[model samples]
Target: MTEANLTYVNGEPTLRFERRLRHPPAKVWRAVTDPAELKHWFPAAVETELRPGAPMRFVFPEEAVVDGAWDGEVLEVDEPKVFMFRWHQDVLRIEVIPDGDGCTLVFSQTIGGGRAGFLAAGRTAAGWDSCLDQLAARLDGTTVPARTDWVTPMAHYIEKFGLGDGTVTATTDGYELRFARDLVWRKPADTWPVLTRSLETGHVTKEEPPRVLEYEWSQGGTVRWEFVSDPKLGERVELTHTLPATLAELRPLALATWHHRLELFFAAATGGVDESWSEDRVAELVKHYA
Candidate 1:
């Protein structure tokens, strides 16, 4: 596999990449173009007609399935050889060339924006890298590793919010994060209060989502919430928070606090206790949340 070449066309964004795989045309073609086959790697629902002028959609997870999707039209189709489609309102081409047993897959995307768009174009390029790796692993029938590179983003968030030294308790509602430091509470919409902040000395730094925030006080680093799932539980509701760290470090105090948050959210939301988060039942919840 080779890195994608990214460029801008008249201030537009574009990305391109190439990969060689050890499979025949049919195998390689299905791997890249099939929705069921893609799920084994990317873990998302894919919808497309595999024909010209048809719409394609890739949705992220919410309820063990896709919640939102990107809708685009297919412009060209040369089946098992080459195909082009419209993504982000731009053109994307994918080509497969047969080798001895496998084939070479070449992918490219073109966007009509500027520098900002070109920078953003790199995101899809990286995403392709991840997705292709998963595809390879799937072809080999191997388990894909969970991506857990959250340390940098966590540290960045801590510094930006000016968050003070405070103990974090794992709560079920989310994370019962209370800043015990002495600081003045500024007006509403303060990034510090909403994200992370220090109540003492008014030292606060805010880190945006999908961005890293770090804390050096503990070598173990700070807790981070990744994905959130809102599930229906009869009259109540269960908010599942996927923290970056594992269950071992969050045990004892932290675990209890997290449970409390879940309880609070459910009780307040529907005026009742949600038994799904009970210790005996948490294993199941963790499985889904993980």
Candidate 2:
């Protein structure tokens, strides 16, 4: 399988991957369509007839990977050639083309025009890539060990997709931060759970929908978070922590903590490994601010 490709279609995002299977298209089609074979590789358990316009339901096998079910409709079915369906918020299309003795399978998912999903394309594509790897192993009558590390590949996709570009700068007032934060699949309206997951729920000074929020920090000063949608980067978070100029001497400590918090929030949001906080890590980052 090749690296997943990313592209935008009329302001929507799409992720595509291609795999060269040594098996015939018929065999591959079964792996994609048959419930038994699908259980080996598909991310969710599929429940639907193989026909266009049929309602489709997908229930995840593992609640840890994902909980609950998603509903969609089968869009098209061309025997041994094509299978297309609406997958919740995205459209999933799979195509198998005849290639000498084997087959070339093209799988693509078109993301809906939403801010949350597209922003985490890296994580989503990496997840699908892992599933495709399993599909290849299943077709070959072999098994693949489950991947334990999602952060490394996700970082690659994040950079490749030009995301997670958040920065912190010291200012006359205090500190300013601009970083890409994953809202998971939610807008800022449902961000309280994420915000209070690691940090305490300070007094909410201001609360706004889909855009702005502010709160009084327990550590003194005020914290504000803003959501901005960019045409290229999709959606991002901008934070401002207001402090007095007398606190300038502690810029390194404050900025380092906030900087690491950015990545920590991102990892948790994207379902990746979270590094434990340490003084050494903060000290290393402090050099940048100094």
Candidate 3:
């Protein structure tokens, strides 16, 4: 599978992916257009005639279902070369370039505007990443289970898009942290002062004893801490950070700073000192992220 490339086109977020397969253009084209072959890898089972201006309906399985079928119209159909369609408010395009006995497939989707668009960019890219992986497996004649884990790949996409560097368990208006641990016997109210004092800045925004505490970071983000009961981890603390898009050059530094601060928070809460927490360690982290 190829890495998804994200860019802004006409102020709208667009995601593009390319894959080089050993199969010829016609074999790849049929796999994308034919419903029987598509069901093996595509998110939905497609129904339509192979032609331009044809109406298409995408049906999801009962076990892995969505709200309803995705209805779309084929915009262009140049056999074994290009297939373009209108999917919801987004345009999906596929181009096949012959490469000797093999072919390269380019897929692009234009994501529209609003709060949802920004949030969906990472998710959509990750979904396509998995689908393309599955497509590759199918072409290679290997049987693999459907992918149910999106957290790992979504984190990669989030970082690739220069949003932030953290393990994202979930993403809505902002990204959710993947770190969750039982903080020994500490409660949210008791934790708040330690967090504030250690950071030396940031004011508390919302505080609910033992449950939720939120604060605004002086640097440029909001941090929320929540305590919840987990079946496996028992009582655990979850932290979430929301940050605006920053300049590309500053992303690595910003990510390292946040990671370092989180380390400090953990040390303060546990009364444990990490010897690795030093300038050299931070420089190593910056290099790793870079």
Candidate 4:
């Protein structure tokens, strides 16, 4: 997938995606603006004429995670070159540039402000990522499945932006640690204080003994722990950490730190020492995740 970069346009957060397609500008333009061609790849069913100030309605597929329709106006329409539109409150602009026998597509969206804007950044980025993937497939004359699984990609974008749902699992290690839940209810009474003290650095957000425990970190984000009885592992634990949207640069460090902490937590919970929990080990794990 093509990586999307985050930037600010006019004081609003923006996501920019670029792609070099093997198709010509006219063909790419038709694929983007022609409703008939759009249905094969575009997420929503658009209804409107391609002209400036034209009203448009986007009807989402029934299976979409975000259901319902949104109304907007065509902000600009420089045929075969630029197509800009407003969807809800966000502005989407697509610019196509001719390059030899191919063309380059530059897509950008202006995100809103506040927490909602941060959250939308990931969702919108992932959604467009999938749509563009489909578009590429369409241009290549290959079949690409419709987007049905958004959670995985959304999680990716969330982590990419330094905010996470906060669960890290090492399938090879047969262990997972999550910060949002508690290990106290299922573990031995002797381990309760250790677990509680380890989590004391963060403010408790929710607690429901042996089931759910949530806390907000002093630096940023929230952690939630959940316990479930797996048939294979008996009582299992899962942790989720949610970080704020503004800390994109800290994602790598945050992931490494969390991995180290979880290793410590695992050792403490099991009453066994993890000698492998070292700077080198953490670096290796971080590189593996990266």
Please give the CA lDDT of all the candidate structures.
Answer: 0.49, 0.74, 0.67, 0.68
Model 1 off-target regions past 4 Å? 8-11, 42-44, 63-70, 112-115, 150-290
How much lDDT does candidate 1 score? 0.49
With a 3 Å backbone cut-off (N, CA, C), the pairs that clash in candidate 4 are 165-241, 166-240, 166-241, 178-239, 180-223, 180-224, 180-225, 181-224, 181-225
Cα lDDT for residue 161, candidate 2? 75
Best-performing candidate as measured by TM-score: 2
CA shift of 66, model 3, Å: 4.3
Clashes within 3 Å, all models in order: 40, 1, 0, 9
Q: Which sequence of candidate numbers ranks them by TM-score, best first?
A: 2, 3, 4, 1
Which 10 successive residues of model 4 have the least lDDT summed? 177-186
- TM-scores, each model vs. reference: 0.49, 0.67, 0.59, 0.58
User: Least lDDT summed over 10 consecutive residues: which range in candidate 2?
Assistant: 61-70
Prediction 3 TM-score vs. true: 0.59
lDDT of 4 by residue, 62-152 (tens): 6343335446889999989999998766789999999889999999998743443454465678878888988999999997777665555
How do the residues 3-70 of candidate 3 rate in per-residue lDDT, one tens digit apiece? 89987778777899999999988889988878899898887777777788888886756523332554
Clashes of 4: 9
lDDT of 4: 0.68
C-alpha root-mean-square deviation, candidate 4:
12.3
Best by lDDT: 2
Give the residue spans of candidate 2 off by over 4 A: 64-70, 166-180, 183-222, 225-261, 268-290
